[model samples]
Target chain A: MNTLKINYKNIYYPPGGILMWIIIFLELITFGMALVAFVYYGNEQRELFHHSRMQLNTTFGAINTVFLLTSGFFMANAVHQFKEKEIQKSSVFFKLAMLGGFLFLGLKSIEYYHKIESGISLDTNMFYTFYWLLTGFHVIHVIMGLVILGWTNYGMTKKDSDTITEDVEACAAFWHMCDLIWLLLFPVLYLIF
Target chain B: MQKSLIFVYGVLIALTIATALIANFMLVSPFVVSLIMGLAVFKFSLVTFQFMELKKANSFWKVSLTLTLGLIVLLIIFLK
Candidate 1:
């Protein structure tokens, strides 16, 4: 019988999957602060806060949700491919996931452009402040995920497959974090009042 | 396993669209809307647990990660 080695301490250590745990922890802290700001500001101007929500395109938010979810699926498939020792197949999925991230940014840019044209700038009011701050932070993470995905694909082409699996795994984890954070953000920022 | 997960993925996407439409179009109470939105969170958790196989991971890690996410949600609720 072949026995798999298990190390308990490794489960909670840095550079292990616990790196994701740390990143997630930081994200939760920042998002929590943002929520507090939103509530505080919303209370100061309740009508404007709700009215700003009415201007947002729920359709755009819905489409972005679909895009991020699909990207998460591709990232999962990429990890599966790596587990199967199909390096090229895994790289393809990583690139596809990055493409999804790019598509999301494009949609978001369009949404912002329309908002600006309609005179709903970030300086418009407190709600717009939260809208821009939360979603803008989210877009930064999306771009970072895409950059990580691109670098992972490049590393796959340049290095031995076994040498890069850990990095690829880390990048996939980050990309999925990006997706998961958006899942939370979409409901709070776009769906709810 | 992967194919079935993909099917579940499709169902999740459909649920998001359905929930968004209901939230936007219906005249439901905020409490009822939150209930529906909570259902979406359940479906999302199902995908992460079943499709992503997080349930099969080391139990300690999964539990800690879940606790962290719960804390985030609790903070959001703190505002209301």
Candidate 2:
């Protein structure tokens, strides 16, 4: 007990493992830099930016925001439940979380469809360029997140799954990273001009 | 933990509604833009601290995430 307490207090390992955290920080830097560049171009093409903003549907964006928030909420619950050794419950929560991700993808794909139909391709303008590249990159991450969550779910079903707690936590961290990036993207791409 | 998770979800959803309303109803201005971005930062921190459990993370993780969001928001606001 004393050793455990000392380790907890002194060493302070991050949740979801250190490697995942490193990946997260790197991902954040990449997305942050892209957004900064987008802002720089936004300043140059103010009118174009405004027009692109008008083209987006904030209602769809808000719905997707809810989808991600709810998904992250479920993923966090899954992590907590797994820690408590409630494997069944945790698996359920993770599935719900995956459902949320799919919903987000569905809505976002609809938005992309509208853009493509209206002749708003990647080269439509500077704002559209950032919109396609940044948000498209984010869409890929969402798809990847689904794969991670599914893998974690598979891990939960196997014998000795409890021993792979770090994998579960790492997957949760990645899903939440997707959630976090969308929190940034929804505002920049949908709400703010 | 469950209660706090629920509370965070509530706040995040409410903030989403608020973002939509402001965009649809309010007059567009720099202040409005900043407000939208501010709300985005708030939502981002909520997910990071609550879902990511960064609140319990080491100081370095906490500071790093905060500074990353800070840099992006500042660049967006000032650069434009």
lDDT of 2 by residue, A43-123 (tens): 888788988889888888889989989999999999888777788999999999999999999999999899899999988
> What is the Cα-based lDDT of residue A33 in candidate 1?
71
TM-score of 1: 0.86
Which candidate leads the pack in TM-score?
Answer: 2
Q: What local lDDT score does residue A74 receive in model 1, on the 0 to 100 scale?
A: 84
Off by over 4 Å in 1: A1-10, A13-16, A159-162, B50-53, B75-78
Leading candidate by DockQ: 2
Task: Count clashes in each candidate, considering only residues at least 3 apart in sequence or on different chains.
Answer: 0, 0
- Give me the runs in candidate 2 sitting further than 4 Å from their true place: A1-12
Return the clash pairs for model 2, or none: none
Please give the lDDT score at residue B21 for candidate 2.
Answer: 93
Instruction: For candidate 1, give the docking quality class from DockQ.
Output: acceptable
Residue A25, candidate 2: Cα error in Å is 1.3
TM-score of model number 2: 0.93
**Each model's DockQ score:** 0.40, 0.69
Error of 2 at A80 (Å): 0.7
